[model samples]
Target: MIQHSLDALARFSAPDDDQLKALHNSIISLSTEGCGPRECRALLNVFERFPDHDGDGLFSSIVHLLEPCTGYETMLIKSVGPASVPFNALMSDRLLNSGVTEVGGQSLMALLAAAKAHH
Candidate 1:
């Protein structure tokens, strides 16, 4: 999991320094054992920012981080439930209105559709 997480972070080749710093800080703040449940729950809020990502690489990185986990089904569902709302909003705002460039190779609507399909 840690290896995957590191790989996920690496996908964001040149993230904004401040955003990267905040993400790093948040990751470090999570107690692997002491507050595992709470940290897991917090992932929902964190992933919600993915759709609003202005950086292609960073968007891919966030998608990789949110990839479906085998035994972590409960955590995954909980995380996606809250994240879906803002994520969908972002998609609608960008894809249905603004002419913002797609992230990496996928459009906002396509990404959201894929995410919903995964769920």
Candidate 2:
């Protein structure tokens, strides 16, 4: 799914709705639960390339996901409002700055604040 998202970004092919939904869930997990740096780095790089990708409704999915965030996604979204920045950029920044390694043990509010500082 990650590779598909990255490939979709690279080849200018819009991912299917299923892929977009998976991407949304994957991003939500990445933001809220944390993952290895290698994984985070790969996902972040992939996401960084997506702001210009069209046809997949990526941005709209992001907005929709963030609008009704189920968990930590809500805290993060509220930091800057769901519309404050492009979702790809915001997620990449959050991955890099949010000290995600500490995610499950810490309040997302602080992590989001860290992300907000950089955004």
Candidate 3:
């Protein structure tokens, strides 16, 4: 879960160091403690810059905190409810597995699509 969170965090641009790390911890805490989606959303929302994300800034973030990857199965995208696990979380794992770049053409939409599929 830590690795997943770290991978998700990588998609974000902290410019300054440690900001993403702090966000990662907050998200994990929210998810593991079973905090409401509002809490989870707040934590994730803080790190993302939103529509300003070079297009439709997509997925990423923490769910299992700093411990091992035990609770990933229980995590989900905040607004989408627990049913839709963050595509970023899945993408982070895909990225580690070299699944991202192998996705598609040079188009941004294609890339996002691939990330979604692979994840």
Please list the Cα RMSD from the true structure of every candidate, rounded to 1 decimal place.
Answer: 11.9, 9.5, 11.2
TM-score, every prediction? 0.36, 0.32, 0.30
Give the distance in Å from residue 91's predicted Cα in candidate 3 to where it truly belongs.
11
For residues 45-119, write the lDDT of model 2, one tens digit per residue.
Answer: 443445455436555544443433335343433433333345543553565465543333555455556656765
Candidate 2 steric clashes: 0
Q: Extract clashing residue pairs from model 1.
A: none
- Please state the error at residue 17 of candidate 2 in Å: 1.2
Q: Which pairs of residues have clashing backbones in candidate 3?
A: 1-69, 28-65, 60-88
Q: lDDT of candidate 1 vs native?
A: 0.43
Higher-ranked by TM-score: 1 or 3: 1
Per-residue accuracy of model 1 over 23-114 as CA lDDT, tens digit each: 56444433232223333444444445444553434433333333332222244333333246543344334434647445444455554566
Sort every candidate by TM-score, greatest first.
Answer: 1, 2, 3
lDDT of 3 by residue, 35-70 (tens): 443444443443344423322222233323311343
lDDT of 2: 0.46
TM value for model 1: 0.36
Q: Rate the local accuracy (lDDT) of all candidates.
A: 0.43, 0.46, 0.39
Candidate 2's displacement at residue 5, Å, is: 11
Q: In model 3, which regions exceed 4 Å deviation? A: 1-15, 47-59, 62-119
**Backbone clash total, candidate 3:** 3
